[model samples]
Target: MTASGALDAPAASRPMPSLAAFTQRLRDRLIMQEDPATAAYDRIMRRLGISIGIAGIIVGGVELPEVAEQGRYAPAWWTVAAVVLAFGWYPIIAVVSAVSGPRAIRFVCGCAAMSFLGALASIPFGLKLHTVDATTVWPFRVTALAVTAAVLAWTSRVTVVYLLTAATSAALATVYTVSAVTPQHVTENFLRSAGLAALFVWCGTAATGAAARVDRESAIASRRAASQAAAHSRDRERARFAALIHDAVLSTLLEASRAGTKSDVLQRQAERTLEQLDECRGAQRDPDLLDARSAVLFLRAAVHEINPSIRFATRTWPGYDDLRMPVHSASTIAAALTEAVRNSLRHAAVPGREVRRTVTATVSAGSIRIVFTDDGAGFDLAAVSADRLGISMSILGRMRQLAGGSAFVESQRGEGTTVTLVWGGDGSR
Candidate 1:
């Protein structure tokens, strides 16, 4: 069957897709062709880094006085510079890294490495001026925790090495700076520094790793489901071809054999059968394009099939019905519209609240525009999970893949949702 015919099929006649198959298709349609879960994890980690970086800045600012008092031990300017680089500059870099592209990961990692090296140079890691007191808190130690978290933008293995190196360096520096070094002191200092850094690193690593694993498994499952779908489509096509041959070719040949060669009726039947066969071959080779009228009708039928209750309206300008577009473009628009209506029905229809859904299709100036609107319970777009493919894949992604096609979804809690799909104006093929 043609794409349009499939859409026009009665809802009851169409077999419902299994839950696993539906889930697989949704995962496969994610906007990112690469690891989508990994991408989401990166975004989350970047935000977390920014938060930690900012917190470090605030903590450093509060400890500026204590940090300044250490001026007698280290050069005054050097002390202040270390504090600024570790707290102020580090967080600023984190903010930039979060907002920037992939290249920013290296930049952030470099910044973290510099901060660690600077801390090493200022050895003693926040030592008082020749004081033997072990009760003093190291301000740089707090900054180290945030920096370690930022380093997570790199590979986990690299981050682990950096954490160990920084922690060991801080411990040795503490031992050297104190007047009296003891085994207990060394172990305590090392554990203190490593513990803080490890906490941050572990959280980031666990979250990102889980995301990557989910993406990998989703990809595998989606591929398996796709293979099954292909097999089903092939089986259906084979059955259809068998029936066609039996009903048309066999009947025509039987009629011809029974009637003699002189029968004009048999000749006409045979010619008609040949023409039908040729048309079937042509359909297999190339899908038929839809004219503007046919496209509008197809979309109307599709919306009705999905939801018979929706109010569908169509507007056409002069010469609109004469325009023609590729079959794929028309089917894509229909599919996107179908998803929009489904979303409205599924999410917008709140109990005890009356909901009204409408679809408008406008064909004019060689372009097609469809808008699905619902006066029902809306939702917060930001609250939607990144992995959710309802709007991103079913609506936006499908339209984006079509030439000269675009989609927009707007919604607000307690308000309503409006989805607009457009295709074929400029840049159309």
Candidate 2:
């Protein structure tokens, strides 16, 4: 499926009412969250292209002295212009590739093609130098070409195509440079350029492999998180249903046992049983329009399920439970709150002692705040790894997706950790 379709599919399949459905809703929210993959790719490509382009100008500078010193060799103009044009074109192409949606890879390959031509254009100069100063090598003129090839390799997935191009360029440059000066030493020049080209292409190949691995791992992680959330939601709903049934049916049975065969008591018990059954059936109806109190209850139940022992410290201002927000916003807050509590349970502990943590939900007129605080050992926020998706992706990212929402983390080593999520629906308030 396309990315958009994949994101919407989960939400469409499960309408929010049951805990499982809300969990799926949060999972869908996360899936719909903006991915950094595009921006990251663009930044790397732009940097590579601009850096290489600058290097090209410098390499061309080295050749200018040769062209000027050679008197009026008309062919020198072609080589010099080609060198300038090849380098000057890169930054433009890189910018275009970054902005161009599906054509980025193709644009990058075009750079490789241009780079090869730039190197080949230096052949006239190489020939001219051979006629003037036959003993000196002209390898420096081709340095721009090698650098361009490396940049292309870094961005392109088809490493074989780049390697083939690099190999062909090395062979051509070697043959031309050697034939222009000394045919007898062609073998030595070929080996040197070919070896360097091989090394460069090998590095490019390694880069391609590493990028592919990272992309694959990111996809796997996203899929796993979605699946786990769906399953967890289902389990929570099942437990809720079981509890409802036990409370309703078992209570009726106990009442009937105590007051057996009293006609009025039996009648009342039967009527109560029917009412409970009706309530149970209605319980599966949509929860998307829930008031603030119901959402808070759901949040409390979710955190309690994660760890039954941790005490909850909650407070609210007047009209706190009566206020309403969008279902998506509510689910996002709950998921983030759950994650914050889980983080505390996992990492909020000193080396030799267990400490209690508390999760608090405070609702005011326009917004709500969920704070998870623990006295257990905490570390520097800057010390956290970029790959830790629990805080970055689950908590901060989820909150940021909401229109008027933010996440805050305050922690210090040997002190404690506090995660605060503050949000006002769609930012209107």
Candidate 3:
């Protein structure tokens, strides 16, 4: 890639990279490294845990007084035990069996067992409470129903059938308990319980469907990204290999074809072939390996296409020789500087005269900084509009995206401009 276009395309010719592509960029963006399925599941579990805790607290408090008053029949301790196990089950097991293959099945079975046995134990006591005081203690049972639904929604890797089955168990428990305790309003109580069960099942089904959609989309995006990345890598490698062949192998082969069998010519040709082989090997090394010197060389080569009138100068900090950096970072810095230098050549000029520019690089304890300065007419930053995105996007934007990197621009009319690109080892120097 050309130096100017490496980090960003010319804004005038093309729009900035789309958000999808920006987010999907290889090697530095975390989106490429994260699994969306895992993230979505974590969110689901967190929401489920929070909702369960809140529901348990509210319902348990509301039902506590009635359950406590009827201690002769519905012992307070047993009610507390059921509440603790019923509400706390999912939150505990969700964490413990988070990655377990049978977690969904276990959760479904557990919810059903809790609702059934809990209703059986408490319904008789609730009937006694109603007989004595006409008061109902169904909050604990209702809370169980709601929490079970939430648990089902959260851990629903199993088919919708499991949710339906749990909802059926909860409905039957509610109907049995309500019908046994309050025979006069059996229909109303049964409908309420069945409605709650149906509502929860519907909620669980909807949540499961939504989560499945997210997982599906994430999987598709990941596969597409991987396929595209592989294809792009192959294309880039092919181009680089072709360049190596043209620059070294082809030239040497052509010379060998033209030269007669003179000893000197043959000897030189053989030496060139060996050198070419070495270069090919070097090219195949880790592509990101780069040093300050090499970065400067790349910057020089990249700027060679600009007008020759504007002179380019580069210098390194003393005693900090051979500053090594990630190849990707080095390339980004080089590209940014190349753009800065070109901008200087194009805009940093007197009415009819060229100006000189300098690119200085300094290495410190854990960071590197490069500054491009030129003595040319500089425009006001505020006067620039959104459409003029070259410096804003191609240079500053790209630098900011690099890990622990930042870019700044300082310019005043007649005083010229200075664009600084700095990168540190842990995002700060």
Candidate 4:
């Protein structure tokens, strides 16, 4: 399907949105809500995280027992240690709560703190809980696994949290399970968690890499399209201007010169014709109208060549310099709209002995807007899928290559069609 038809089809079969979409949305919203001043928020978070980490180490040593053993029991100091952990954790939680972006950073912080504290407190792991039910520690294990999985899911970063959390959970679960502690189901769990975490990391990374590649390819395609269009327009302009010189000024001057019988009179007329030709040519050749004028000159010259009675009116497009857009962006906008004009002119009916066709070009911020309203009867743009596709794909496709910009056509029988094209962020000479 052409780019246009591709745009008009049903929406049900679209691919699932990418994980990158999550981060993009987060960042966009963050920028919108807090603006760039939120950079200070990140700095403050980092400082708080660091301070919290230092406090954990100091309090862990002070409140927890000096000796450590895991298999037999809980420490007399477990409550005191939990109290200290709660105090230190609150500041980091507050930082995370205020953060306006991807919670991947917060997840990492929480996981690291949980894993470190859980493992170290295991210094007295076996000291208490002589006969505990396996189901009792189940939540702890599950929470550990979930948090580790979440970190892997969100950030795709490899960390010791996975091993530390997994090990602690499995250890506690194994100690309490009624069976002979067969590695069968328990080992399977370890392998399963590892596998899931690995898959998430791989998928996230692969998706991110693919997205970047697509973006680069799109950018390259846009540049090439613009360059080809610009080159084509330039060539078309020269052809039309050459034709104009040949017909009006060049032919008149040549004919006058050939009539030497009225030599002085003819010579004066020839000189006047030559001067007029130069002035007209200079106006047509103004670089500001290079591509826009190309379309006008080419359309008018070609139509007139076919039939003198056919009148084509074209107004020179405004200079793009005022927009100050980047070159590729400008080129894409100009090229797409130029092609649309060509298509509109080509599609119009030419049955009459006398025909009047009008084409106008408008340039606005980073967009080359063109409307070719003609006297010819117009077709239902929506009904004609092929022609509609031509506009969307040829025109809109060009715009899409410019950061997914848009192109559309509005038409009515006996009225006319209007084609709109928009290019991204910048479009200027």
Error of 2 at 116 (Å): 3.3
Highest TM-score scorer: 1
* lDDT at position 167, candidate 4: 52
lDDT of 3 by residue, 1-429 (tens): 001111111222233256833422221121111222353443454444445545555655776665565444555666666565454443454342332222453454356445534654555544442343432344435533553544453444442344444445544444443324544454454455555655665665566567667767755654453344334444655686788688767877787788776668667867877886787676453334344455455545445534444345565566444354565665566556666775666455555444556666666544677777776655456644443346666678778888877898876555567888887755321
Between the candidate structures 1 and 2, which one is better when assessed by TM-score?
1
Cα deviation of 125 in candidate 1 (Å)? Answer: 11
Model 2 Cα lDDT, one tens digit per residue, 110-213 = 66555655655565654543343433334334543554445454544454455455455645554544325455555555555556656655554455456556
Q: Candidates' TM-scores?
A: 0.60, 0.52, 0.42, 0.40
lDDT of 1 by residue, 322-369 (tens): 465555566678767876776666555545546777888888868888
- The backbone clash count of each candidate, in order, is 0, 0, 2, 16
- Give per-residue lDDT, candidate 4, residue 349: 39
lDDT of each: 0.63, 0.56, 0.52, 0.45
lDDT minimum window of 10 residues, candidate 4: 1-10
User: Which residue runs of candidate 3 sit more than 4 Å off their true CA positions?
Assistant: 1-37, 64-116, 125-188, 202-233, 247-274, 281-429
Model 4: residues with Cα > 4 Å off, grouped in runs: 1-73, 76-132, 135-180, 206-229, 244-429
Best candidate, lDDT: 1
Global local distance difference test of model 4: 0.45
